[model samples]
Target chain A: MNKKINWQYAMMASAFLILALVPLFMSNNYYITILNQMVINMIVVFGLNFITGLAGQMNLGTAGIYALGAYTSALLSRNFGLSPWLTMVAALVVGFLIGRGLGYPSLKMKGVYLSLTTLAFSEIIRILATNLMDITGGTQGIKNIPRFRVLFWNLDTNVKYFYFVWTVAVLLCLLSMRIAHSKWGREFKAVKDNVEAIESLGLDIKKIKIRAFTLAAVYGALGGALYAHFNQFVTSLSFTTDLSISYVIMLMIGGIGNILGNIIGAIVITILPEMLRFLGDYYQITFCTMVLLCAVFLPNGLVSLPGRFRHLVKKKGKGGERFGQ
Target chain B: MEKKRYLSITLAMCLALSALAGCGGGQTPQPSQTQAAGNTKEESQQAGTAGESSNDTAEGASGETILIGVSGSITGAAPINGLRTKQGAQMAADEINEAGGVLGRQIELFVADDGGAQDTAINAANLIISQDVVAQVGPNLSGMALAVEGLLSQAKVPMLTGATSPKLVTTIDNPYLFRIRAADTVQAKLAATYATQNLGCRKLGLFTNSNDYGSGALNVIQEYLDGIGTAYVAEAHNTGDTDMTSQILKLKDAGVDGVIIWTDDAETALAARQFHDLGLDVPIIGSPSISTPQVSGLCQPQWLDNWYCVTDFTASNTSDHVTKFVKDFEAKYNETPELYAATYYGSIYILKDAIERAGTTESDALLKALNETDNLQGVVGKYKPNTMREMVHEGIICKLEDGTAVYLDSITVED
Candidate 1:
């Protein structure tokens, strides 16, 4: 068992090493830009995985959290002329508090009802951002957001941005993995699978669920803050319900309950519609069809497919004379 | 099984990447691509011994293929403007190409939809610049134009807009940015002067849309009014907002003899109808953008009585080019070309002429040609580049009589 754990650790480290090196070989500015977007999406999805995957909470208001984080960071940096790094920290803290507040309401509801409430919350936030023109620039959107350096790296180029976002994504993923495997993570699973049993054992199931959601919100908010800086702009359109749904799709497609799944899903979904651009107007329709087909056939999602396939191949090799091979 | 999974993943990735690449409106070639292609052509020209300095000749020859990029709301709320703009551009391009093309090469058009959104307009501008198009047209709305102007200025690509708002040019003008139409200030001054002089309208009330297009026109009118020491009552409404009873009530209360409206849709006609219904029998003077057939169609006969509007183009006008365009457009679309179409048509021609004059499709040369423009005849009127403060210069004021627009004298406003 210890040896098996060591192998798992080695694989995780190597996977991260590969992620860290992706920007080195990227060809053009456009590709690097897209990759940077994917990395930011990965961080957001990883946070979402905690809420939807671990705690079995269906919060469609992830985009609202993202917008809050983005607006908080941007307004702080732009209006107050504060350091953006400090603003990002502030955004995360605010996100954490808001998430806890929102999670409190969810304790009274569950399933689709909870999902609807979250969806309404996101919609409300989006509408407020749009209508409050004096402060939020209304529908014209906030522009000319100051670009900041990520850590010690100069993000003057897309290549630099690729490395910056990737580094953050990996670090967040590592943290998520550590939390996912911890005792609290097991409690989260307990709450998700059987809340009654968890409570019967005198465990604070509501506390676990709220903390998990709060943690996820923190992840989404930080990701949003990073995105606001990365793109150097934020509009109400960026944080619509469509974005939240897209994040859900990413989580589902990549394989819920796993960090690597979130990353893979983010990359797949992010790049999929972009690739469909050749189809012109028809691309969106085709993308929707593909997504529906995936949902129907691959119930466990795309992330687990490789591992499942490997398992199948090993089983087949043991059973037969390897006729196909 | 692992191999198959890998193959599927690879295929999926491949399909997605290709689709994204395909979404690009055109082959936006890099600067390196252009320079390399220029070198090969220059080498061939050098062998022919034209002696016009291959560099200069190459630049001129390259300019022959006039590239005009148009961006507008193609798939969203304002798809009509985008589609009509493209049609207008295509018509002009066809004419230029038929008449042996500009500078002996075919005119090419690259178009992208702004999605009726500001951010999309910025993206479209970047896309056009990347494609190395010499000049731009349309992006009809003021908000879209403002968002794109920054990128066009950065890329040094000349944008010949049809958007008439004066504020659209608020950013510092480089030699690269030029307008074919007169600004809203010019139109507002003309409308104000015409009202006070020709129509004997005094104590006017102004109604305009709440957006940049409407509000911008209102500002210009206010400035003109301030200049003339004329006091007027003003009210604003959204583009598609149907109710104007409150506005009409206010106008009635103000006891204004004439009401000037700045609108781009049937809402203007609706306002007129609402005005008549509310028993306010006042002469309405409207901005150029208010003269769409859709407006006339919505509020006709009684509603349109004594309605005056300033427009760059009139469907009834009998200029040779205008006549030909109307006939062709009528046959194709089964409707007369609106003023927006005419403006778009003119923009394409103006860009083509500038490209030919510059003798290079490069943005810098095209921009110079656009800036130094003077006395170029278009379907709308004569385009004097040096004097053009906006997309239009001299808007002809016309009055609606029996569902037909009767052209009055051209109103050219002083600065």
Candidate 2:
């Protein structure tokens, strides 16, 4: 078992090493931008892996959390000339506040109702962002938002921003992995498995749920803050229910409750649409079809491909050879 | 434990890396794939709106095809503008190609659908820039236009816009962004002056969109109104709002004799119809949207009574180029072209003329040629680059009579 755990850690390290190394070879600014986007997405998905993936609660208010985080950071740095580093801390605090504020009331609702409540929350945020032009800049959005500075080195170029965000993403990933593998993670899954048993065991279910939500919110906000600095602009149009749903999709497509799955899912979903652009107008439809197929055929996600392949090989070796590979 | 799981996952990463390489490998004969797909795909329901999304590289061309990029919100909020942008650009490209191509090479336009979303617009801008377009047109929504302006300027590719927001030029000072349509300031000033001077309106009521495009214009209109020492009541509404009775009632209670509205297509029509229904019995002057076919078509003749608007192009104009453009456009697309189509169509020609004059599609040369552009007659009035990069300096103010827009005056400002 100890050897197995060592292998798992080694595997994760190699996957991350590859991600960290790819940007060096990528000379294209567009690809670098896409890479930065993937990093942000992975960070968001890692947080989401806790609440929706592990705890089995639906959260469709991620857009609101992301928007709040983005606006909080963008306004502070652009308007008040605050350091982006400090603004990011503010964003994290904002996320924590939202998680507690939103989580306290809606965590009690089961399934679809929770989704609707969260959805309403996000919609209200978007509407307010759009209607409140004086502060939020309405549809025009806050532009030329300042980049992050690391001890006098500004992350102005996409490459520099790529490394900065990737660093953040990696640290967030390790923290998320630790929590996912910890005792609290087991308890969260236990809640998903049997809430009655959790209640009977004297575990405070609400507290556990809120803790998971708070972690997810913090991670999500951090990701949003990273995005604001990297893009150098923040618009209300970026925050929509479609964005929230895509985060859920990334989590589901990667494999629920898995850190590596979050990374893989974020990378694939983020890069797939760009790769499919040659398909022309059918590209959006084709991308959707591919995702739907992945969901239908590989219910456990792209992370399950190896296990499924091994099972296929074992079955074929044991006289199921008539079935084609 | 599946020990080989690590190997398979690593292989997946390899596949993804290779895919990323393929995506970034721009201008490596990939456009042909798009052309083939666009040809084979079933006809989309939104006909002609597909306008210039993809283009075929014509065989037997003299030199390499000059690629021009066009992008707009085809499938998002305000799709009409995007579709029109594409159609106008497509029509112009087709015309130039038929007229023996520009600079002895066929023009193939690459259009990206921004979906009116900020993230997608940036992606679209980067996609087209990677394809090495000499110039770009559209990205018509003002907020969207502003979002991608920095990207265009960084790439050194000049952008001729269909968006009329004055901030595109004023706020950013981006040298690459050239506003092909008359700025909203022009429209607001004209609307204000016409409502007050021609219509004998005083103590007017104002309606502005609660967006950057409308809100900024509100300040301009207010400044103008204040300069003239005119008293007015103003109200703002969101982009997708259909009912504005509450705001309209406020205007009514203010006892204003005339109304001036600065808004987009649907809202302009909605406000006009509401005014007619509520029996406001006031003369109204609106922004360019009020004159667009999309808005005017939505209204009855009765609703159009006493309504006036300032627009870049009017199908009723007797100008030979304008009429020829309208006739050719309607014949080709089977739809009437309006604000977006006219400006984007004219912008294509303007960029084409610059490309020809520069004798190379090189960014700096083409940009210089665009900057020095003056007195070039196209579909939308005359093209002349100004200090503020405002391309079309003149707007025609038209009055609606019996649901037909009658050209009343042409207001050309040198500034």
Candidate 3:
């Protein structure tokens, strides 16, 4: 999976270049905040791609996984006065536990049943977050969580935070790509495409499924930790079933199992709503309409638009039936 | 196939790149969106006053008018709260502008809708902060207020909101916020004192929806009841709980003489109906939520026979200014204005008073003027900042006669 001077690598290079140069031209921190949020979403989507995108498991408990990470990081750092970096490790461990916890249900159930199990798990977390007033501060949420600080460096400003999150996101993305392209990646896809074939070949389907779930949860928890520190606040209400579904939407609206598509999906979905803010009360409705259009037209997401056009053009040249595969 | 991959990858990122382009160009006002910005409220949507566009952070740079940003949950779970804030603030701005604008400039109210979401609320706050508003008001709920208070303090823009939770002042020690509504500590005491002194009840049963808002009030009421050496029982239910009868029945089994209910509008109405149906006939005192049109539209008239609520503003008040407000608000919005409307409406005038007194729209000067606010009359109550910068300390306790809140007594918490 080593990269040459290829177009895909070129695209990644230019995208990062554009991001690095964005704040130079734009002085406003609001846009920088949105960029930072996109980076966080990207990391979560990277995690989500493992189970829901690559492995063909529909996991909908992202908010619960995320909240656990955020709360773990926020509470540990703020309450115990631990370094944020140390608490982030704690968040990952919490994520691993949650992944293992929910991984059990994925094995016991499949499809809609598995979805419901994860949804219930997420809701249980939210309810606990809301009710455990002493711990999570109930619905009022924990605010004033301090920003990241090293020996002398403090990522306090929006621009500084964006770069830190972006660096982490890029490093995490490369790691996820490595895993997704590894031998294990093929087995995960094999488990999705034909579990019977993999099982007959003596490959442990249980390990594959659990590993996918764990990877997804781990990514989600890290995203949550980044979010908690970025906003310097954590509210239970912020993480809802809607949030879980949005990540799934990011997966579908990007090409499923496509790494590059996931980033595109997260960026488009997250910032699209903000762009539609000009519509006032109707902005959400308009955004839903746009997403529906994308879903209906590009079933494989925006990543397939070029191939779709090429396919359509070749059919026309052959005087073939329109939309003929 | 490789060429196709290259083309597709470039095309794909171009999509995201254009989105980034959209962000860079976001400050420019889109003419197509301008018409959509005007809502279908009333002829009240007249003149230059729809300056309240939630996304108009870009336009206020002209500085012709004194731009004041407002943040509210206009599109999310509790949209009514945000709408009421918008309507109330709009009316105040219109009145101020009509009476020859503040500081020789019209007060342009720019509203940023948070949709009851903390992240969106933060975005709204940042947009407001970037808009260079002299001062800001309202992201009405306590959670939204606390989330944005630090930003307001950091930006040095004073904010006034109708948040009732005492935690807004107590939890975060931010000096930028001034709570426009009576804190729950004052309101809870009023409900308890009104029950014990006015209704002449001995034992109090605490029935509450066990959410953040409900439990916060529950703790305060429990502390007050405990201080008074009153025997009490407690029962709780979820926010959207269907059958609250078990909780009510538990209170009844305790043989409590009076019940203090802390919950939101819909559930409070449900509880009141259940209390009536279950024959728990002692005085039923409720939090401020029950005094609004939300509860009135839900419960039947007779169900409120023995019901009382501690509130900051009631429509039935016969005070000269309040009636005038009630009449004007009803005429303009074609509905009874809730406490949110009243507080935000008064908030605009309060800012006007501050600007006029301070003689400058600068942040520090206006903040100083707001901090020095004395018995300044507001539609809800008098405007006077306590030590915590909470504006209103007194709350009106009202009993429902026939679906109308009949004001009984005004309880003031001594600082």
Candidate 4:
């Protein structure tokens, strides 16, 4: 078991090392920018994984939380000239409060009702962002958002932003991983599988559910803050219902109850559309087809591919020997 | 068993890495592939000669090709606008290339779809900039233009778009950005002026949608009406709103002599139909949307009678330039050129003129040439950039007569 854990750590380290060296070989700002975006998506998905994956709560309000974080940080930074770091803290606090406020009220409603509430929350945020012209700049959106700066190093370029975003993403991943492995993580999962069982265990399922939501909101806001600083712009159009759905799709495709699955899913889903861009009008159709295929064939998600592949390989090996003899 | 699991995982990682590497490799071959497939023999020979002369004259100006990036919504909501813009820009590029190209070099256009979203627009802008294009043509929506203005300014690439927001050029103060369409404020003012001065409207009823585009137009029209001292009653509706019965009743109860509608095509049609159903015979003035084929087609022919719209382009106008543009656009795309198509088509020509006058694709030179633009004729109108980088200031008010939008009067605002 210890050896297996060591192997997993080694794999993770190598994977990260490769990512770190990518900018050295790939110098195109376009690809690097896409990478930065992918990392931001991963960070958001990691937070979302806690609620939808571990705690078994569907969060369709991610885009709303994301917009709140972005608008809060952008308004603060643009209006008061606050540091990016300071705005990020403010965003996290706002996200936590909103998530708690939302989670507490909706906890009694399960499944589709909760989903509808979250969806309504997202639409409400978008409408506010659209109508609040004085503060949110209406649909024209807020521009010239200050980039992330650290001492003398300004993260103005994509390469610099790549490091900044990935650094945040890695830290968030570590934090999420820690939570996933803790006693609280087990309780969250217990609530997911059977709320009655968790209640019988004397755990306050409501508190655990709200806590999951709060943690997810923190990650979502952190991702949003990083995104606003990196893109250096924020618009209500950036936080549509489509984005919320895509985040849910990424979490599902990456696999529920798996940390690495979130990262892999985010990367694939983000990069796939870009890769298929050359297909012109057919790209969206092809992308949806591929996603549908993945969902149908890989029921456990892409994270289970390795285990499935190994099982198939062993079966094939036995069949080959039988046929040869 | 553990070993097999480890091997499979390692293999999966390798496959993923290779897939990423494949994407990188895929991009490098595109330019060469297009060069091989898209260039004519004569053009290739000219490019070779131009390449040598360019290298001798300047370090970076000798390339045989100049790429202008075009970004807009080729898919998702409002794709019709994007499609028209793209077709118009492509038509311009093709025409230029046919006419010996610009400055002895072929024009290459890299078009990306923004999906009409802010984040996608940013990505498209970054992608286009990475190609080292001299300028960009779109991200056609106002919201999209605002989102990408920062990135384009950072790259020092000039962008000419049809987004009607005045802030695209004014509030942002990004010199690299220019607009080919008249701003919404200008359109609103024209509507207001025509409603009062030409139609003899004293008490006006203003009906507008609630979105940024609609509300922005509403505010400008309100300010203009106030300036003219015309008493007005105003009502707002949401974008997807189908019922305007209550609002229409209010306007009729107020006994307004004229009505100005600022909304999208579908909503405009709905309101017009509702007004006719209610037997309100007041002269109605609408923003550009009511003049669109989609909206005009939806209403009864007589329902649209005496209705006027302040539009950027009226294809039925008798100008020789517009006639030719309409003819050529139909010949090429088999569709009538709308305001979006006309404006984007004019933007490419305007950019081409700038590039030719500057004799180089350098950002500063192109900007200077653009700023000095004077009365260049195109499909939209005579192009002349004001101090605020607004290229087109003229709008035509077309009235619906006998089921067609006929040219009524031309209004040009002086800043």
Q: Which candidate is the best by lDDT?
A: 3
Q: In lDDT terms, how accurate is model 1?
A: 0.70
Candidate 4, A1-325: lDDT as tens digits: 6654554454555455567777988987778887888889999999999899999988899999999999889889989999988999999999999879887855789999899888899899988888788788878888778988879999878898898887877787788878998987998899889988877878888799899989888889888888888877788878888999999889878887677778778878988877766655666788899989998998677877866888999999999999999
Give per-residue CA lDDT, model 2, range B104-202, as digits (tens): 877766777777888778888887776667788868877778888998899888888877776677668988998888887887787787887788877
Candidate order by TM-score, decreasing, is: 3, 4, 2, 1
Residue pairs with backbone atoms closer than 3 Å in model 4 (clashes): none
TM-score of chain B taken alone, candidate 3: 0.91
Interface alpha-carbon RMSD, every candidate: 8.7, 3.9, 3.6, 4.3
lDDT of 3 by residue, B1-415 (tens): 7787767667756875786787667742232232225443443343344343333343232345777777877788877777788778888877887888976777776677887888888888887787677778888877777788888898888999887777797777777889888888788888888888888888889998777888888888788878888888988887558898788888899999999998877888888889999999888898998888867668898888888999999988889999999899888778898888998999998888988899888777888999999989988889989888988978998998887778887767765
Binned by DockQ into CAPRI classes (incorrect, acceptable, medium, high), candidate 4 is: acceptable
Full candidate order by DockQ, most accurate first = 3, 2, 4, 1
Q: List the residue pairs that clash in candidate 2.
A: none
For residues B183-206, write the lDDT of model 1, one tens digit per residue: 777777677777877888778999
DockQ of every candidate: 0.16, 0.44, 0.45, 0.42
Error of 2 at A37 (Å): 0.8
Tens-place lDDT per residue, model 4, B1-415, is 7787668567756865787788776542232222222234543333233212222222123357677778868777777777777777767777898898888877766667788887778878877777777888898789889888778888888889888987776677889888888899899988888989989999999999877788888889888888878899999887668999999999999999999999877898899889999877899998898776756877889888768899988879988988988898888767888877788788889988998999888889998999999999987778998877888888999998866688877777864
Cα error of candidate 2 at position B76, Å: 2.0
Q: Distance (Å) between predicted and true CA of B25, model 3?
A: 2.1
Score each candidate by Cα lDDT: 0.70, 0.80, 0.82, 0.81
Model 2 C-alpha lDDT versus the unseen true structure? 0.80
- The complex in candidate 4 yields a DockQ of 0.42
Clashes of 4: 0
